[model samples]
Every structure is written in structure tokens, then in C-alpha cells.
Target: MVEIKFNGQRYAYWQQVHISASVDDLAASVTLAVTRPGTGQRLGVDANTVIEVLIEGTVVTTIRPDSIRRHVDANSHSIDIEARSLGRELIDCQYSQTLSGLSLDEIVKRLCSTFNVPVQVTAKAAVVPDFSLQCESPANALINAARAANLLLYATPDGGLLLTEPSSAAPVATLVYGEHIESYTVVDEYKLRYSDYLVKGYDYRNDLALKGAVKDSGITFFRPLHIMADKTGQGVGGCDRRATTERNRRQARANRIDLEVVGWTHAGGVWDINSQVRVIIPDEDIDGVYLIGDRAFTLDDQRGSMTRLSVMKREAFLGDPAPGKAKRGAKHKAKSQDERLIYATDLE
Candidate 1:
């Protein structure tokens, strides 16, 4: 069940509502359709009206209408409302500053306070000195700072912000393909693969000279792809760390196989973005742990309720050496076998 509240009144006359939330740097949004008020009716609302969305008795989001449309015909009249989470305010609020010797958590907290947005930081990141940035908005600054620390910042269901390390929590539930999954689709992309990473930084002590390459290796084939990265403001150790982190990220994304599944269980209330989940699929020979990267919650009187999940490998969330390898042995073997067969045939 869904409820919309406006002007100190609760409304349950909505025909349908859809809520989408994701961990992939997207703002949670709500779309609802309600019966239009009749002539001389006291109910009044507009695009600027602040509203709250309640799902199954829990306050899911606080938003203001981004757009409102009215549908009128001989048969009926209805109003469609679209709203975005309060986090959108951060994006709209521009900021400019330079701070030295502040950690990622401190920066996020300060920014959130400035914008009057509540924040919760689950994990702390390494502190850096002499950080400087100029962004058009506070959101952009926070995002870039989080990226440097390998963290993620997103809006929570209750209109608060969350800054945390992905895949740091344990799985809340296990999903079996034949049991809870109603339908699913898988996508595997590997066209952009790299085996070596070269990260260059500046040596401040040596009169701002460009530092040498910091290399890291990963699994690859076909001409040993090389990737270059600039860590201009970072130190030598920071550059090395950045190279390793980027290499792990690239390798994980290159060999990534994502799954989109519609399941029977109610995952919205139980799981959030970056939540770990154990998945088993016998037919696809897949049995591993994954992270919930994206999710959509839907409920209707006729169709019942369902949750759609975008599951990605742990590497996508935790980078590398944390969850180790995902289920890619079979696919790798098949590709290698095909290559060997082609070479043998040519020789014969």
C-alpha cells in the first residue's frame, strides 16, 4: 500500500505509484496518479507542494513535485505527479571551497550540514591533505571526493544521505533462481579490457616534477591493453594505491556479468543499494555472492507486489581482493578452448 501526504492531510486515492531507487548515483524518484478534485473541492496541491510517500506504513521519501500533469476527458479527470528525493537539493545548491587535511567523511558531513541535509557515514576513508576542488554544486564535489576514496554516497529512503563503503555489510537474504526468482536476464560485456595500468603523479618535493609510472597487472589477452591515469595531486604512495584500485575496478567491470531479476520476496524493505546477496542459479551454473546495485519497488491491487533487482558481482562493489573472483571460470575456459582449437586447425 502507498500513501501520499500533503498539507497535513493523508491521501490514499492514488490509482498507481512507482518508486525507483538505485545505488548507481541516481536519485530516488516517485511517480503517482491521483483522482482530480471536483468543482469547488477544497483539496489544493501544485508542483511546489512538499509531499511524503509512505510504502507499507514506512516513510519512503520526502519530495516536492518536479512536474504535474492533468488529464481530462469526458469520462474522468486525473492528476499525475512526479517527484524527486530531497537529495536533489544538494545538486541544485552550488558551493565552492578548498580544504586541507580533511577526510572524506568530514567533507561530506560539512557539506550536508551546510545544505541542511541529514547524513550517515557507515565507514571512514583515509584522510588526505592539501585537497582542492571547484565544483558547480555540492553534489559534484561530494561525488568526486568519494570516488577518490573508493566510497559511495547516495540518498536513503527516509530522505537522508548515506556515505559508505560498498559490500561492507553481510547479505540479508539468499535468492535461489528456481525458488524466489520470477524472471531474470543476464548481460556480459568484455570489449573494454585492460591488463596493465600506469598511474602518474607529481613529486612536489622535486619541484613539481612528473613522477614515473606505477604499474599493476590483471588478467588479460590480445596485445596487453595499457591504461594511463593521472594522479597529479597525489603522493607516490597515493599514486600506487590509485593504480591498483583502478586496475581492480577495470578488471572487475571488464569481466562483469550482471543480472536483472524480478523476485517474489519484498526486497525494498529489507535491502538497500550495495547490500550483499547470495544468489544460486543451477541452470546458468552460477553460484556466488553479488551486490544489489539497483532496485525498483512496485505494488498494485491487481498485480500484487514485486521487486526488481540489478545484481552485480562483488568486485563491482568492493573492487578486488575482497570477495576474490566471481563465477567466470566456465566462460574463460570456453573462450580459451575456442582459441586453441582455431590455432590447431590452422596448423593442421
Candidate 2:
């Protein structure tokens, strides 16, 4: 069941609820449509109010209202509320600072602290000799630093920040189509991939130019992507690592599975991002363990309750190629279209 609470009171008679979250994004969102409320139960929700969202008695997230719409007519009265996690501050605020000789963890904690946001770094990241920012969004600075270190930075359930790696443990649940999943869509778009990825940058400290190049062996034709590296891509072999990271992320995104499940809670608890799950779609010949990158929980009169999940290969986050299973299609030379595609590697 879904519940919304504020000011030590649980709201009742909400007609619809929708919550969206992602591991790649720093903010989780909630939208609610409330029906008629008795006198003195108007909720008194406003922009200053903070809402606690719970599923099956477990707290999922906390949100601050970004928008609220009230509808009233002679016959009916209703309210629509939209809110987002506290991390929204980082995305909205800008800062100018030139940080030097700090680890990625330290840099992130420092920036988050500016907005009174708590942070927890669970992954291992190297200390950089120098880092700088000028009129930059704290979100952008945090994202770049984390990406360069191959780490993940997202909002915790309590609206704090968590810097970590993808979970490497066991699969949280095994979801089979027609059982746990109500519907699914397989996405395969080759245009997102390229034959070559070349990243170029400059090392201002040494007054030298840097270049890093990687390739996607899946593309039989000639397609190349050239990227001008940012400040984070200036150190030794930084451009090369950036190029490889780009390739892996794109390859993983090129092929994904979007699933709509029946409920919001899994065996353990609420559906979470960055957790691995086993997916089995017999008709599509897709049987693999995937990482949940995005999720949305929705409830309404029509659908009752459901959760939509967007998942991709786990190797995508690990700086490795995630070769997909062969799809039924016209052959490309000796290999099928899917078989020809490999992770971000320079192999024939």
C-alpha cells in the first residue's frame, strides 16, 4: 500500500499517487491527487511543507513541494501536488570555487554541505591533485567528479547524498514475464552507438594536449564520436578513461528492457535503483541479470498500483562492454545483428 504523511498526520482519500526515482539522477519525485477532505483536514500543504512517502510501512523517500494545484467546483474539490527530493537544491544552486588536492569523496561532501545536504561516500575514489570550479552548478561539479572516478552519486531515501558503486552482490529478485512483470518493452537502437570514440583534452599544468580513443566493435560501418574533454578529463590518461566510459554508457543504454510490474514492493522492500535483478523473457530470448537504473511507482483508479522499471546490463557501470544476446533478425555476414555488437572494446 502507498501512504503520504506530513506534519505527523497521514493523508487519506488520495485518488492517485505517482513517484519516480533513478540511480543516475539526484532527485526523486512525487505527484499526488487528493480527493475531497473533510473540514479541518485540508492538509495545509505548501511549498514549505515536507512530505514523507511510505510503501508497505517502509519509508521510500521524502519530498518538498515544488508545485501544488487546487481545484474546486460547485460539486467537487480536489488538490494536485508535485514534489521532489532535497537534492534539488544542488541542481538549482550555483557556486564558484577552485578546489585543489581533494579526493572525489571530499569534493562531493563539501559541495553538498553548502546546501545543508548530508552525504555518504561508500565507494573508493582517488585523490586528485587539483580541482576547480567557476560559476558552476554544484550538481554538475559533483556529477563530473563522480563520473570521472567511475562512481555513482544519487540521493538517499532520507534526501541525503550517497556516493557509491553499483551493487556487486546477489540478485535481489528473479522477475519472470507473465508472473511478476505485467508488461515489457525491448529497446534496441543502434544509432546511439559509434564505431570509434575519440576524447581530446588539454593538460594546462603541463601545457600539453591529451587524447584518448576507444571503439565499439559492434558497428560494422564507420561511425565516430568526438568529444572535447572537460576539466575533469585533464589528468594522466583521463581522456582515454573518459572515452571508454562514454562508450560503455552508450552501449548499455542502446539496448534495455522496460518492465511494468504489479506492485511497488518486492520481496525485500520497495523497488530500488542500482540493485540487480534477474529478468527472464522467454519469447525475446532475454535471460540475464540487469541493474535497475530507473523506476517509477504509480497508483490510480485505472491501474490500481504498478511499478515501471528501466534496466540495463550491469557491466555498463563497470567500465566494461555488455554484449547483448542475439536477437532474431537478418544476418550480418556470419554473425547476427546482436552478436556483432560487443562492449566498449577494440576487438575484431
Candidate 3:
């Protein structure tokens, strides 16, 4: 059973509800409809009202209403409410700054502190120099900073933030193609795959230009042509190890396929974002393990209840590759001291 609390009050007049949660975007949302109150009563909920949804005695999400709508007909009246998880707060808050010589953990911790938000970190990350950016919002800045170190930052339902590596848990459930699956769709997205990457960075102290490239020969000739360029920030050391680490991270992310499958199973509270599961499709000769990236749970009078899952290959979330010890003796010529007083050119 599902229950809802609106503004510290309990309500039980909902006719139907739909909930969607995802790890890829780090967000959860709900849409619910309730019958209008009788003769002398009025609905007391409005946009931005806080709401908590519980399923089977467990809190599913703590959200705020994004929109509210009312409908009136000859026989009855009803109101519809839509809400999103607390992570929306981060998106709503804007922040700007340039951080130098800070670890990924420190940067996220400071950002959360500035916003008075709660945070929990479970994994370790490398320290780099000079992360500078003007983001559209605080949430964007946090996400981009984390991604640079191959980490993920997402919000919990109870208004807390989680920074960690992707989970490596065992499968919670299994689904067979002709047995439990109602429908399924597979997307190869071959064009997005890349076989080689060219990474470039500069070491200001040594006045040296660093360039590195990596190629994966695993891909057959049928799809052989692909390359990408990457620019590393100032803090990344100008060494082969750093460039190799960046290349491996990029390749792993690009080696993915998009898949969505619908099944008639009670996976609502049992399965969640970042969980691993086994998917078997005998007819298509496809049977492999995958990570649940997104999920949608729906309940109604006619359709009863069903679960839909969006999944990706498990290798996509592997840990970052190691960056070996820095190289020595690399040097370059410095600019002449006599040219120190260069003047800026003005445009006419």
C-alpha cells in the first residue's frame, strides 16, 4: 500500500499515482491525483508544498510539489500534483568560485557547507590543482567536479547528499525474456563508441607540452574508425600516467548500450538505482548482467502494478584506472625575460 503526507498531514484520497526514480540523472519524481473535497471543503495543497511518499511502510521519497492542477466536470472534481526529490534544491541554488589545490572530496564538502546541505562520502579520490568554473547552478558545478575524478554525487531521499563510486553489489533479481518480460527495447548506439583518444595537457612549471594517445584494438574492422580529443585542467601532472588514466575512463564510459525492459514483477522497493541484475533473452542470443540506471513504478485500477527498468552494461561503472608515479627530467625552453612587458592589442 502507498501513503502520502502533505505538509505534516496524512491524506488517503488518491485514485492513482506514478513514481519514477533514476540514478543516471540522480532524481526521483511523483504524480498523484486526488478527488476534490465535498461541499464546504477546499484542497489546501499548493506549488512548492513539501510531501513525503511511503510504500509498504518504507519512505520512498521526500519531495516538493513542482506543479498542481485542478479539474472540474459535471460529476466530480479532482486535483493533480507533481513533485520531485530534494536534489532539486541544489539545482535551485546558484554558486560561483575558483578552487585551487583541493581534492574532489574537499570541493564537494565545501559546496555543501555553503548551501547548508548534508553530505556523506564513501569513496576516495585523487587531489588535483585549480578547478575553476562559472556554472549555471551549484548542482552543475558539483557534478562536473566529481566527474573529473571519476566519481558520482547524488541526493538521498532524506535531504542528504551521497558521493561515491558506482556500486558493485550482486544481483537482487533476475528476468527472463519469454518468462516475465512484457516488452523490451535495445539500442546499440554504435556511433557513440570510440576506439582511440588523444589527450593533451601542459605543465607550466616545466614549460613543457604533454601529449598522449591510447587505442583499443578490441573493436573489429567493421567499426574501426573513431577518435576523440580531451583537454585536461592545469592541476593534472604532465605525465604519461595521468593521460592514460583519463583515456581509460573515457573509453569505458563510451562502451555502453541503452536498454529498457518492462516486466510484471514486484520490483518497486526490492530494486533501486545502481543495482546489478541478470537479464536473459534467449531469442535474441543476448544474456548478460546489467545495472539498473532508472526505474518507473505505476499502479492503477486497470493495470494493477508493473515495473519498467532502464539499464546499461555493468562495465560502464568500473573504478578509475591507476595513475603511476610522475615522470622526471622532462623540460622545455622558457620565454625570454626581456619580453616580460608585452602590451595587449586593442580591437578597433
lDDT of each: 0.59, 0.75, 0.59
Error (Å) of candidate 1 at residue 193 is: 4.6
For model 2, what is the alpha-carbon lDDT of residue 23?
73
lDDT per residue (tens digit) for residues 190-253 in model 3: 4544465444444554665555555555544443322111122223332343334344444544
Q: Point to the candidate with the largest TM-score.
A: 2
Off by over 4 Å in 2: 37-42, 235-237, 320-348
RMSD of 2: 9.8
lDDT value for candidate 1?
0.59
- Record all residue pairs in model 2 with backbone atoms less than 3 Å apart, i.e. clashing: 321-343
Off by over 4 Å in 1: 34-49, 191-237, 243-268, 299-304, 319-348
Reference-based TM-score, model 1: 0.74
Candidate 3 deviant stretches above 4 angstroms:
12-16, 35-43, 46-48, 194-268, 300-302, 324-348
TM-score per model over all chains: 0.74, 0.87, 0.73
Q: Indicate the worst ten consecutive residues by lDDT in candidate 3.
A: 339-348
